[model samples]
Target: MSLREIKPGNHGYLYVNSHPTGCRAVVDRMWQQAPEPAGDRPGPVALVIGSSAGYGLAATLVGLRAHRMRGLGIAFESAPTERRTAGAGWYRTARTAELAAEAGSDFTFINGDAFSDSVKEEALDRLAAGFGKVDVLVYSIAAPRRKDPLTGEIHRSAIRPLGTDYRAKTLVFKEGVPQIGELHLPVADEAEREATVQVLGGADWQLWIDALESRGLLADGFRTVALSYVGSDITSPIYRAGTIGAAKQDLEDTARAINTRLKGTGDAYTVVAGAAVTQASTAIPSIALYISMLHRIAGDAWQGTSDQAVALWDQLVGNAELELDDEGRIRLDGWEMDADLQAAVRTAWDRIDTDTLAASADTEWFREQVGQIYGWDVPGVDYEAAVETTVPWPGSPSTDA
Candidate 1:
């Protein structure tokens, strides 16, 4: 199928071939922009759980390219089977291997669910045999559903509010300009809230680390962090104060527990990121509105996955020291909440309607970023040409001519 011709599913999720050039653009920029570290001593061996796209992809890129480190990227990405190709994550993983090879870096991509105990064991086995122990384990897995490897229970995340329904100005992506519309959200019940926490919270992160530690896969001086987010007051009803927020609170609690449990080895952190349109963010209620308003206020400063990854990774490695909040969490949401910027965005947000939305928020940029998540809307890519779906995985036989 032609890349541009591929349509999104009913839920607005599109599956496309990941753009190699666009992926390279992100890495190249990160390589050039990040400060050159002193000494020939490079960073540590890392393992990124959700290591195909978004922050996980960015973290793997930094480890292999910028940090001059070996890494194992484990992601539950499907291979290109039959006529249809796998989603963009698979392509992104393939491209990461290519980039790593060119840079003479040791990198591996494992295709399996990070939430599964069997998959975790496989990763552990690989890490034990190949790298001994990882210095940093970045748990960046974001999934809609998680089947508890032990209990055989399935958990799904919810993004609705707790008490009442939420109605807000939201963006509807279309042919050209995004149409602004009012979206009504439902309220999540107790069961839904618990389910979201189980899937999206830090329990899995803690479990992964515990498994690693029990098997002695985590090296001394090893650190771990699972990404979290806390947006401004505007979207709290659906995000920070919703079912998802409850999960994050659990995640943050797990971070503290890890800190206490693994005193000598290292500490676990819950790094709170900003409100940006992501695969995960799509599930959040009114994300379109929140992200649009944020972009309006913060503009270029709204931290995307790449720069945010760099910042978090820098903190993880102790290269950069940030003043963490009271809960000992790293806050890297960018300038969206800045007083002056907040002041500037209110005028537009207050008067925002279908007509004024185009004028208020950078909907073009918003859509571009959202599309880039699925390997669409990227510049300098020939979408009309056929994209080779299968690519070499690590040291596997070449799928190319």
Candidate 2:
């Protein structure tokens, strides 16, 4: 099939062939901008969880581009191939490895459930044998649900205000229209909520760090960071203040715990990042509508996923001192979610006419943003080229078949 025939949700295969040249362009820019190692040591090694797509992938790219760090990415999903779609990180790892090879830097990828103990052990073993230790660790995993490895029970999450019924306007991205809906907060028993907390919260993070430390895989002066978002009060009850909020609270608290573990080790610290639209973010109710309205109010052209990732990378690695409020969380989304800004967006959302949504709302730009998440809309390449690819999944032979 031709590249144009490839759909946006069809894994990430189309990215390899759709804009091969543009992909090369980004790789070249990364290589040129990447800093050189000060000494004879191979540059710092970075391990990024959730490094398949969104901010995680951007962090990996930035490590190579901005810091000249060799990286190992751990992703839970399948890798994308020319004939089949793969997860976001899968394609990203493949692409990054391809670029790193050309740039003469080390890049390895592991495909497994990062939350699994076996996977953690394998990853530590690989890092120990290959790089000895990692100088930076980035945790950006965002999963909606997880199976209890011990109990084998499935748990799901909901987006709603805790303890109160709330009504909100939601945007139907495909339809490009606003739909008002009632969101019922989950009334699941405390056991379920606790399970959700255990699965989605900071336990996995703690496990990763503990495993790495036990294996002696963390380098001295290393920095470890995790991403979290506390949306505005409008979303507080459902997100920052709800069950998920509780989970995020645990995550934030875990950061402090991890920080304590890293202290007195010369230069270790933890960071909690601000909000941005990611694949995970788009799945949350009311967020798309919120982002659409915010995009209109900002007036500056909206950026694609790659653009947002680049912005975040610039902030985190290129400029580490992100503007923080008294609370210590980086304030990028705080500025975006400022009361005044949100009020303006709320007004714009209210003003959106139902009949003329195509003209009234920048649906085209939103669609492009969605497309760019899977590497569509990139420039300077023929989407018709046939490109072969491979992922690091075990027993999967590297093939052009």
Candidate 3:
């Protein structure tokens, strides 16, 4: 089916199946824009912690296609047992492994929890036996909750505003309406907040590094990166500047600590990626509305999660040293959160007096970009052709099932 026939709910599946082709295009564009990888040393081995979807998988594909790196992905989600299946991150890794096979590069997928000691040990063992050491380690896990393996206590994360009553205007994507609402920040007692900090913050990141280093699985002159985002002040109380914001602050600090640990070898950095609409981003209370409006105002042809991932890969993975401000965090999201940009968007939003918010907010470029992310607006591809095909999961346990 053409991308148009696939409704909003199933769009993510379609994107994953088509991502290999999309990633190829991204790689071609990156090579055209930037210089090639520095050395001919056997293509670097990379391990992507959250390699199922979003930026994690994008970084994996970018390393493969643009930098010619061999990769292994570790995802907590279940793998697909059937062809043309739509499990999260399934199609991405499948497609990536398929292409890697075609190019004679190694690719592996491990379905397990990234925080567990056993899983980390397995990953390290595999890397040591196969590739000796990994040159790149990308931590991109974004789970809503995590169960403490030892205590059996489940910790859930909240995206609501914390400690302050904040009023905000947001968009309803389904109804295509703009409405104002007050965000009731959660009143988490001290323990809950501390738990939130422990679960969502950077402790797991540090743990992963410790596990790898203890096992001596890091390559010399290795690079490691983690992804973070700081959204607009409008959503700050709920996002970066709020409870999750506190988590991110811890994450940034962890990045610095990790960088210190990796100092003699090479570099460890955190990428404060720009905000685009992702499954994780959309679920936040006021963010969907913000993204919808931000999409309209920025007018730089806003793309979906896949496109954002591709752009991130091009800028951060394919090229080293992001455009960082004096604060040391990369500033891709800065433009989106720019004071003037947010102010103008807010002004335009206030003027949206009627329910024709979709029409009022719609821009030709934004629509076109969203279309492209779903494989709609791209040129030279026959939309009518039967492009639907099974996702080939390389090295799956049994093809029969």
Candidate 4:
């Protein structure tokens, strides 16, 4: 295959093509930018579901680079074909392998649908054969739909409000220019609510834990965490008070149930992460607007996914004590939820329109962050250079492929 520069082929929230070289560079920067490990601590074997991009990938990198742990990551990603490139997650995984190798860490990546029973079983077998047991499990799967492995039923998640139509000012692009837009989201019906919970909730996390324990693959002092989100007042109507919130509530409940099942053997907690630009977040109405303004206000102090991951490791394994809320969930969004910051954000929100968007928000930074998600706008990368789209992932071939 001949080398060629790859630009993002989709608009708004999704990217259909990725540049392998640029993706690797982004991963490399994250790995390098991470703080050094605290000490010569014994490495734990970690299993990270949805461990290819976003917070999942960040968690995997934290395990390998910060704690020196061996890891197994399960992510569903596309394989490259003759006419197209694989997703950014594929290239990120490949880069992870290289960094892990340099750090004397080992990671076994599985490319398959994490919701499937077959993939779960394969992970169990791999743990039994290669690592013996897993000390940490990070559940970070984010998908639009999930297929029930036992009943063959499919559930799709929704982003609608719970009881009323939600209207919010959102960030949008018109003819390649950033502007303010509005979103009017309707209420989610009972069926849609249930489906959202089934797809995005902790049902899968519970199953993964149950399977590991049933097979005696959980190591002593085991710990698990599922990523979560709780939007601030700015996005409460469309986010925290919406269908996605219901799913997150279920996730919290599952963590509690999993803790009870652990019964002194291990613990489970839901981690509410800080706001950042991710593919999933992009899909959420007003999130981009909020994040962009937040970035502008917070400047360099804002926590990127990598920063959040390092802080997570500090709480989970390092010396820092876990900052728990009243509900016993870990809080990583303290900075994002600061009172003064919120006030500033709201003030900026009220002032933003297409005419004022450029001056009011960090639209350039916002666009750059979105572009980097698909490996397009990383600094120092030669986008003019030719590159291969058929980059091989350092993992098992996808079953579908």
| Whole-model lDDT values for every prediction | 0.74, 0.62, 0.63, 0.87
lDDT of 4: 0.87
lDDT of 1 by residue, 1-401 (tens): 22233333333433344454454444455455444445557558888889876677777877776676776889887666545556667767766787778877777878888888888888888888887878988888788889988799999887788899888777776655477778787888999999999998887898888898888877888888788888767778888888888988999999989988998668788878766677777656567766777787675676766677778777877779964888888888756667777666666667888887767777777767767776666777666655555555556676655
Which candidate model has the greater TM-score, 1 or 3?
1
Task: Tell me the tens digit of each residue's lDDT in model 2 across 82-166.
Answer: 5665554455556677766665778777887787777888888888887888777888888867666557676665554556655
Residue 104, candidate 2: alpha-carbon lDDT: 72
Alpha-carbon runs more than 4 Å astray in model 2: 1-42, 79-83, 147-155, 173-189, 266-275, 301-322, 353-360, 377-397
User: Can you list the residue pairs that collide in candidate 3?
Assistant: 52-89, 161-185, 171-289, 240-245
Give the top-scoring candidate (TM-score).
4
RMSD of 3: 5.0
Which numbered prediction scores highest in lDDT against the true structure? 4
RMSD of each: 2.8, 4.7, 5.0, 2.2
What tens-digit string does per-residue lDDT give for candidate 3 at 65-154?
A: 556677678987544333433453554455567666765668788878887778888888888888777788888888887766557777
| Colliding pairs, model 4 | 4-387
Q: Alpha carbon lDDT of residue 352, candidate 4?
A: 84
**What's the ranking of the predictions by lDDT, best on top?**
4, 1, 3, 2
- For model 1, the run of ten residues with the poorest summed lDDT: 1-10
In candidate 4, how many clashes are counted?
1
Deviation (Å) of 37 in candidate 1: 5.5
